[model samples]
Target: MAVEEVFYKLYNNILIETNLQNTNYDAVVLIAYPEDLNVQLPRHIGSFLEKAAKVDKHITKAVTVWNCDYVSGGRLVISPTGKVTPYHDVSVVKQAAQKGVLRALEAGAKSPLVVVQSVVHFPDAQLVAVLGVLEALYTPLQMRERVAPKNFTKIGFHAEETLDEKFERIVRNAIALERARIITRDIGGSDPERMAPGKIVEYINNSFSGENNITVKVVDDENVIAEQYPLLAAVNRAATRVDRHKARVVEIEYKPSDLSRVIETLILVGKGVTYDTGGADIKIQGKMAGMARDKCGAAAVAGFLKACSILKPPHLKVIGVLCLCRNSVGSDSYVADELLVSSSGKTVRVTNTDAEGRLAMADALFKMSETAGKELNPHIYTIATLTGHARACYGNYVAAMDNHSARATNHSNKLQLSGSRVSEGVEVSVVRHEDLAINEGKCKGDDLVQYDTGAKARNHQLAAGFLIKVGGLEEKNLKYTHLDIAGAAGEAPSEPSAVPVLSLCHLHKVFM
Candidate 1:
């Protein structure tokens, strides 16, 4: 099952309400780290501790210390009386409470789901804190349950203090991230063979069935050859032989009601290869295990729309293009020496079929840039799980990025700062014209060529160069940034990282 299909069904109704009603709560979770154990609790909660100490002597004495360090995680206490949790770090106390509350309900609580959902109250120190807290609440319900009970759709923030706009913005972003996470999580767990090009389309279209202020358009496989989107079509040729799925270019446009002020459009392109079998140049057995998650870039965009369907920017329209295809093995697969035409009218000679992400992206980028060039001021950004070169260079903490557009150059610093603030890190690099020049030379007779299977580790830069050509960005002098999330695409092999979604959040704060 697609995580997007199940979890967000319930998550969509979640409300981030201020505690104006002052409803009496069944549980007021008081979470404290060991560091805060001896310190006096906040006055409001301290009142509960004093009363509890007189009634229950166990908490009155020193609480037992565990072996975990102060830098570790935190837990939730169900009682109004403050209690020591098993983990560390006071910041994560909010997360603890959400998780604890969900577990309690799953084990069969008698309270109506809505009452149980509304009654639990916790503290929110900042907006980013809401992200962690939502994780605790939303993730518990993401379990692949068949007949999960209907839950209370709203969450009441019962802080004694009121929240400002910044706090509310955080709450919105947290909600968005929760929506995006489900798609990636489900994709990470889905069988690679089943997540083919056709299946990817099914997942995407299903996730975005009916939404407001948005229109989803696609160039399906039926028109792949007719439209001259040859590169993307070639990538899915192998898969088409075995399945009905075809290479597709999905475009989602967000036009806010007040488009009177929108002059520039922000275009995001995501690489989607549901499963990378490497075609004729297949990967080794062990390396292909996590290959099913190749479509995560597309998942992020779908997730973003799921989260921000109603959050149309006042001054700008946002468009996302998902280059969806599955690089598989069959008689029809494009092999080395075959030349394919891109939507930009450029011909690409296949050198490595496994490097198919760029092929799918090239035509989609060309289509987006072409539209943006004529209609709106284009600010183009490409996000993909493209290369091992990036992962090898940056490890897993930061997603490696290449900025070529002048407008996007200014946001590089913001990307890193915001990444840290949101716990999604970034590392920016310079994709020089010279790098593009050299990679193009590999094309020889053709305009460009995918790198050979064992080619030197220039892939990080090389791949970006190829995408630039297909996008026709440099030709039009359009601004662009390429984010390669290969290294940090997932927490583990079977898990997907909500990587650049945080980067998008950072961008939303700035550009919107």
Candidate 2:
């Protein structure tokens, strides 16, 4: 049931296929310079093959390389229709790669694996290539009502272009696996039973083996309520009525032997709402269709840690918490004006059950913050698909973040640049002390309001402020930030996580 093969890396005796007919390749891919396709007709008809490749450009169709024939070998040529730019950015390569796959399929090539034979390439060429392959794999076939084309999953990359070092291959494969899982889980459909919070815990558990050196923790429903996570318990009681799956908070930890960065511990928090019925405050029918993706923030965190297990940066111990649950309907469901106490000892007055994502994380945030500086140096960051206002503001190009610490503020800027370098973009904004005050005073009895009374324009900022209060991170101790991925998740292929995975790697390697 695991999704593989679509991201395969060919190695050793299969390094580079000089011939397609003698090998088992259904289709091949090659990047060629504009002039290479404009060569004069060879006495052996090399002249005609180059002409056919060029004329297709004038028509703006896919670049048809005559590599499919046994005499020429099955190489699908990749050249920009109007421009011949190198595959430097991940987003650019992703789009081009998806187009290449479609064209190869049109040309009767199934299970196409893009092959790069260039002697010179980008440093992260393999990374860019896999991003494209994932774009194809992650695109659900019209509501996922259909399976892989004819139930045949064939598209992948043969990374002969990568370094021969084993570590490099491991890192590349790690990213591939993590991203594939992230995208699949993020855009997965609204099957309450299939994608329930309980199911996600198992899906994430399977991602790491004993070799990864990561320990996963799942806080059960009984324990959550017992431990005074009334807010999280309330959301769970409402969504999971009679399912028996129950609600759980999942935690992941990785401590590496090699130490280099100044950052000792990085804590990641994510929202894992399996489905959003909006609870008593239900979403309209059209809006409800894609609510299954509500857990994207949590998925990204899980994916980021999976990559961390592979990289195992020096001096870095990573802990990730997935706030798992749903916002559904029932007589037990929480409604407006309900009083709930957070694990931090703060009270929350529920004004909108739809705003349950942040409420779900309240206790976990407090627990993680308390655990942060207990061992190694501490840095806390929260990633969640919490608000739609952010998406309304930025679409999918930028991740809107509320960073803490002058160091974290600088790191957020650096993360944006890192994301840009890899084609994953991010944006940062500050949550003022005044805004935190507003949330803390929004209601009479409770210490916090699930929904702020201020303008809707500030929901994203208020949500950050709420999480900050829950984690006792208001003092901005260590390093803290809230990444509201609502604006950055979905709406495009392989987007929502554009910033999380690469940003984590960059923070650990370049900025820390």
Candidate 3:
């Protein structure tokens, strides 16, 4: 017999032994009483019987015997054929309930199963909070497809209590993150000429309009992002439709309610290269594949912003910056050995087309620092899937964090002030331009192999150095950090990871 049939048989037997009057054997109900109950049955055996009953609709009455007294309780389905699945633990129970329904549908079960786990002795407040979070999570996971498209644009709270509010916030954040992934995957590799950043900004603005206080700003002035930032423009020039396309910076800001508690503003910068083809210095074979995931860093930042909007820390402001464009092969693409000037007016000699993430980030970081200077000059954090060196160093489990020296010192001091032990050996890496090298093939007809020896060996640090150059922040004016998240952003064949998002959320909680 099948698993469901076996469950039904066991459930029916338990119901007959327990003196339950139901003969149909379509469902079973089991009661969990305190240890002092005057029952001769083994606890584990009784629990197992209850679980079996939930597998098939075989029994339907649950009577609790506490101490020497018997109390009549509400009925809980042990076996929900189609609508629900019974669970002992609320967390697992919620997951099981949904999964059981799906499984029944797949198995072509005729009846609707509804699994219910009723808490008999637990505190009402805690139970309610737990149930509320589960309900919020359930709505998005089960009904995302059923919800109208217009509902995606508005923001609403799932639960009302402040103590349990974060749970609902996190659920919404996770949903938005999933939605962003879907949007990005769907729009991937579309004609860059036809799809503009303004369109994306409009979509986001429209979809998330009323619910959360989110402001999406699209910087369309190609020169605003391009003219001085040659390194960024260099890769973009390779696109066949560069003239028809405008490089854009998309900024999403979320501000908190109170000004006094706002300890610091957090700025998240993401490398938004929608598509990357190793330009004139083209990637050969294996290297060019999966370039579509180049924008994962930007996706993470967008995800972080969505999370912030939902979480809404009382005194934290989050600014998400996405530098979006496509790097394709075209006549305007900067060839090997081209010198490009950054927004900070620092000239960078382009050595490789694939090192385009840093180029886009250079201008974005500069603009962010400039903008912050006019405001509160908040602590800034830039995250990007910028280098293979970071992957080699951290292996996708953790992002390489590079903090300004002063900020590191200050953080250590704060730890000490709080009576916490601060490790002396901990250090943050900073990349410098001197670390970068360009191999322009061979000069003239010289057969001797020319090596760019002076170029920086620490690839990750050099990338950070370039951003600092453009950010124009003095050592004293700002606390800045760069997170190289190449390995953390994508899943490997062996395992899946959401390192960047998890790390950002953790950091947000700390600073908020």
Candidate 4:
């Protein structure tokens, strides 16, 4: 499918309403602070809430449905953002909006009007409120293609007391961000067979078929992968036995039309492990059930590139590399203690076969590191759901570790600032001398150890160090950030969270 048919046609169904007077909508989802419930609402709605609050003190704490005459279908959803404190952030607004939308869906309201009483403290409160609505409205790609195609007939957005020009701009920006997120959710949240390496190449090729300023290239030849990316090939050895599951390196590039406007370049490498069987050190105790989400890092890159294509921000060139592979177990599966030469010619000794995410993306990251010098002020990023340690360290927050060059400029802090603007939480972790030292090989034969077995602290940070060393980026003086989304990639039985996409987009000002 072409660009319009693939992304725009499927996702561009949000209707911008002029005001709350539109009676065509079946329900009105009001997301507001608990204290402002009786202030900014319609006269009848406000009167109803004023009376309801006296009888039911707990009405403001959770999602409540009231029968009112102010809107169509006489259904009103009062989803309140609980008491805001100094420690509270914008996520409370997003969560309330989502809960409000879910209540509307449950009430069979195909057309729900979402109204956000945005707080002054949170600058992106309105945009994030709308995103939460879209998150709840999203139907899985497989479900849309096979089961029910329509999640909602139309979603309506109403911003109180905002200018038409400014509201239009916000809606446009929200649409672009949600569209990009749909691509990530489609790839990251789909089943293993549906998003296998070969099929991922096909899906990406089809998505960007007729898009402007976007180019896609795939490297699928097994021999070529073995010759050029030996580290990646080692992980791909068993997957080659099955044609559909074979590895693929999908490179998507987006360069602004005016090269004169380009001031910097971003090289992103993603770990697209479609299904992580753990190779020889197989994940027992039923830990492998949800491994399909392991490719979220690659999925995030694809989604970030999608945002770039939509926003078309000037003064920046973006490159996304998806290292697609399945770490399956077979007779040929590379095991622990096996030595493999990385693309940068670093000999890496594998200490744990389950540590395949870094190996899968190391060669591609090295290749990008080799050419980063030619680009204007290039920054490289490796995004992956790499370690359980990250999840253990920070609950549902993406951990970011920066190389020395990135730390020199406080890149992680900049990212943290942007993440705070949006609702995505980013925790910064430092890659210390101890982290780098932990990855050194035991014997003198190898230049690096794939996984640290003796380390007790900073497992997630150490993983970043391994990637930096194996990619040969340490000596290049290039800025690199490793994002471990193991905690933020969404838990099982839920849609992928698509964390760093929104954060990265905001940091680069790609929000239309």
Candidate 5:
């Protein structure tokens, strides 16, 4: 059975308790008494009327309200067929009034009207509950789509009151975000030819536009590409034979209604390698099987942009940077040990072809920081399915985070303060400037004893440290955090864990 079907079955009682009974009405509304009220007559009467309307089909309106000795008031309407429809209770009086007006307009002269006598004061909890119910009722009806015979809807709530309210909105939006992600992945996997890179961009734009007001920009700069992203070009050499593997940088921006109030800006970057064949330094058979899923980080960032656009927190501007390309082997592909210069003019020695994700991100990080320095002065973060060492460190539950100051030199101190110990079997260590530079071949402590060797057994920690160097970010004004999500990007047997989506949302909330 499908996930929603199973969910419905599990929550049968709760569904029924919400007054969602079997009926021929295309839509139904459940009304409850205000919590601060002291009377029970209105609820009792409404239940009886609801049962009678189910059999007669003439009663179109039903109203349940709280009645107390201190206060009393209620509203109800019924159609010519005796089908009863409930209207505003003490809670959500405005929304209930608006819905009632609409229902009356639809019913015309055949509407049945009933007012329940009650004595109850309006309560804050009732207003919140009623608003929640109304939001749930309108979303499905408003956002309905005819995609694949399934029910797809957009749900929104006014969550500006409290943290719990905001959290509820996040959870609801996250579900929709995950569903969209699954649909995108399934479509890409099933119809590889149809879901090309351009099509993927179109899909993202359309999907996100349906629920948000964000604009997507596709950036193409040959100068920037050659200067900062040579590794991306090298990795796509094979695909260039079929068609020049066009490198794309997707930028999504969320601007506020009043620009003057904007305080802080955040730029989120993702490495988007649609496919990875490991180039000349080929992966083992089993390891190469799931290379198609390498673009999951891009999907997560896309989802985050969609969510942030909809949530629209105050005074925060967010940008999503997606560096998209493919890694394939060909005559022109770079070989192992080839030293490639980044856009920042930093040399990266390609010891392993599988490390292509970081190469794509290196350019994205450099461009984002450069652009930030000029235009936005934003904090930068790059997420990618980059290193297995991250999986080894944090497992699938949490992503490994490397938080450093904007300047490269501050990385040494940040690493130390963050409890990052030197990896075993790696000669190149991230040394403090005050201690000694690795090029000088000098160390304050035992450096040679910690170095290790071999392909699979090589030092992944050193690999991570190297990527930071290539990005050339200053630690003082720039705060860079790299999320290596190699293990969290794919589906698991237990659940569809879109881990990075939630993490990105949380990060945006906290820092932005």
Candidate 6:
């Protein structure tokens, strides 16, 4: 598809309508608690709900459609968020908004006015609700090509109490986030062949062609990749022979216009395993069904860079690397028990070919670590759907493990808090001495082992340790965090969740 044709799909047709009585919209999607339906909602919506409550008892509890004349087309879609609790967070609001938008779409409403009744506990409820609505409205890349191109004509937002500037900021931030998420979802959720390494490079080149302050550099040559990123090249051994599925190193950078405004530098390396057949240690028993999503970590890196390109937040310089490769099973596939030298010069003994995501990213991460020392207050991150042990441990929540420097600064906890506010769950995992020890090579021939086949505990945490060791971050005094998104990258048969993009943006104050 042409760049212009696909560009519009990344953003929503967002419209902000402050006037509650505006009759231009086709439907009113109300998201609120049962008790606040009458109190917090507008007088017209509250009155309609009050009248409907007398006739229907389940009106306040379940998602329902009410016939009313106060709004446009006489269609009112009420999506109730269950009782808010101290334990509950903004995700409830996000989920309710998504459901409300789905219901509005089903009702044949091309334009819907969405309103959220904010809770005191969740300060970012309105923003979360808007994000959720965008999530529901997002059409997959393949669907946009073959089926419906867009979900709605326009999405309207109304806040009960807000100044014009604050409302505009909320809308702008949400749009930027959703736009970034669209890139992530497209690359993360597309079929393996559709989003092959070469195709991803093409899509990225088209997506960020003229975006200001953003630069993209791709390394596509096989010999150069083999020379510079041997570990990654090893994982790409079989696929390198095929032009379409060969490896790609996509480096994206965002720089502030005023160099004096920069206070810190952030480097992100993401594992873009377009398709993981587990190489020589091939996956069996239906385990390879959703392997296309293994690249979500890299997808998120691109999305985060997209957000940076849009917002152009000051005082920060961000660099993102998408370590793209395909771990294909063939005659030339890299097998286990092979010792390969990493970019950091550490010898890695391949213990399990299934553990390829780390190898795909290790060289880029090591290179980033080398550059982190010169940048201003730099922090490096390695994000990947690298382990099943993470899913076994956290179950659909991102697990963040910090190195010594990041742990000293309480980085993971900060991410956890920021993520919770934006409806993304982040769990903090500690990388201990044992975790590091698990990756220690069994024999004297290798410096580190690729996978800990013998030990059973902390496999996910150990993966982080392996990256730190192989990426040359160990004892480097550079702040680094490894995000294992195996469980949270997006469950099977669903669109990519674009995990941690909002969290990182929020933490860095990237939005305008």
Per-model TM-score, in order, reads 0.76, 0.82, 0.60, 0.96, 0.58, 0.96
Cα-lDDT of candidate 2: 0.63
Score residue 198 of candidate 4 by CA lDDT.
87
Which parts of model 4 are misplaced by more than 4 Å? 2-12, 36-44, 161-163
TM-score of 5: 0.58
Q: What TM-score, to 2 decimals, does candidate 3 have?
A: 0.60
Instruction: Identify the superior model by lDDT, candidate 2 or candidate 4.
Output: 4
Please identify which of the two predictions, 3 or 6, would achieve the higher lDDT against the true structure. 6
Q: Residue-wise lDDT of candidate 3 within 132-220, one digit each (tens)?
A: 22222222211333452221111121122132444433333434333333333322322333234444455455544664567887776
How many residue pairs collide in each prediction? 1, 11, 29, 0, 39, 0
For lDDT, the strongest prediction is 6
Give the CA lDDT, 0 to 100, for residue 264 in model 4.
84
Which ranking of candidates, highest lDDT first?
Answer: 6, 4, 2, 1, 3, 5
Error of 4 at 109 (Å): 0.9
Which model is ahead, 4 or 5, in terms of lDDT?
4
Candidate 6 C-alpha lDDT tens digits along 1-512 = 43323433322567777765577788988885756333367767777777888998787577898777887667889898877766877888898899988998898898888875555667788889888998888888887878755667887888864547676678778877888989999999999999999999999998898887999999999999999999999999999889999999999999989979899899999999999998899999999899999999999999999889888888899999999999998989999989999878899999999999999999999999988988999999988999999999999999999999999999999999999999999999999988887888899988899998887688999999999898888889999999999999997677899998999999988974
Q: lDDT of candidate 3 vs native? A: 0.48
Instruction: Quote the lDDT for 9 in model 3.
Output: 19
Q: Give the per-residue lDDT of model 5 (tens digit) for 150-216.
A: 2212112222222354334433443433443343243223222334445566666666554444778
Q: How does residue 308 of candidate 3 score in lDDT?
A: 65
State each model's CA lDDT, in order: 0.60, 0.63, 0.48, 0.86, 0.48, 0.88
Any idea what lDDT model 1 has?
0.60
lDDT of 3 at 107: 36
Best of the two (1, 6) by lDDT: 6
Give residue 328's error in model 6 in angstroms: 0.4
